[model samples]
Target: MLYGAMKVSVGAGLKVVFRPRVEGREHVPARGPAILASNHLSFSDSFFLPAVLDRKVTFIAKAEYFTSPGVKGRLTAAFFRGVGQLPVDRSGARGAGEAAVRSGLEVLERGELFGIYPEGTRSPDGRLYRGRPGGLARVALASGAPVIPVAMIGTDEVQPPGKLVPKVLRPGIRFGEPLDFARYRGMEGDRFILRSVTDQVMYAIMRLSGQEYVDVYATVAKRQLAEEARARKRKSAQE
Candidate 1:
């Protein structure tokens, strides 16, 4: 299979180059469906997490990664497909979250691993952000899959924002014990239950990652940080 071949080739090289240190891999079920809820730190989080796992962990990616213009776009699409990424249109449609939940539920229905970043986006400042209580909780409760809190360490340092070449450093991954929310099953429609489940999973990730917890969403934090940078620049120009 293409997935196996790509994983072997790329995963082998990644191990040789980055030499990532993985812990509690046994926390992952040897069989059956599970949700890998991880803190979003770096773009490489997608590749690195899959590379180290024995089973394929499919993540819902933006549709743009699959559809674009030119040769680079084609290659990007191919790579994402080769690695088993499911694309969902995220262009301000209310259905975007619904589509992602559907995709995740489908993957779980097949009894496979489904990976999700509860933070919704990469941490703007290397700190853990509040988990979005939408797709993650909906899919988990609907499918009754065990949610595993995974932590990726040092990935940002190895591959920081806008960096072309990754630094040679030993990143780490830690998998916490599965957080079972079976009690919340059939209650996915309850917003309060969704928030509770998402918060519990986020707390587990925070403990495993040891990153400072921010009570805000990553997107809001990113925007505020950008505004602060612009204000500083304007002040400097005026001076």
Candidate 2:
């Protein structure tokens, strides 16, 4: 009920204001379970993608969003839940990945759309990063649902990293055709198969979004960037 209400009210309002250019929306299955594997560019990627879609799309968010203390935390938790987000503990990579896969599978079992960022984290730069195969691959293989590659174009411009408020930029969304991995149905545990499937999805997203592909994980890229910044600072001080 809350999700529907928000979709109609808040979602509708944002659509009117932003007026995002959406393409290939018809590619999304009108009914049944499917996985939306998208490139995560900005925090708003979550909101913008679901806002334009007809069916409810659920994404797994960090547990902190739901577990924060006090009034602000409560409100944040409520808002995320209202927007069809499930909270997953992200302390341990393996455990968190497993938990996310479980949540995604549950959503798919209910015959609803599940949204995932195959890249694992938001891109530090606009370049698309290597995808993490564990959650997305496991869920799709387990659920036997078609995976759709979605691209959220120009979202980073609207709300870049570390920005609180979004600018009035014309973001665009592109949905590629569904990718069927029925042949690898029972190979969920196979790491090689998972990587192959994830790479294919990422490649499709790259084509749709037209972002330069980076072969490293987003988290790694972020770390490298921070290291570079520290190095520059040290060099400046020495000079």
TM-score each candidate: 0.98, 0.99
For model 2, residues 1-239, the per-residue Cα lDDT tens digits are 99999899878987999999999999999999999999998999999999998899999999999999999999999999999999999999999999999999999999999999998999998999999999999898988999999999999999999999999989999999999999999899999999999999999999999999999999999999999999999999999
Off by over 4 Å in 1: none
Query: How high is the lDDT of residue 2 in model 1?
Result: 75
Candidate 1, residues 158-197, lDDT tens digits: the string is 9998787889999999999999999989999999999999
Off by over 4 Å in 2: none
| TM-score quality measure for candidate 2 | 0.99
- Report the number of the highest-TM-score candidate: 2
Displacement of the residue 24 alpha carbon in candidate 1, Å: 0.5
The 0-to-1 C-alpha lDDT of every candidate, in the order given, reads 0.93, 0.95
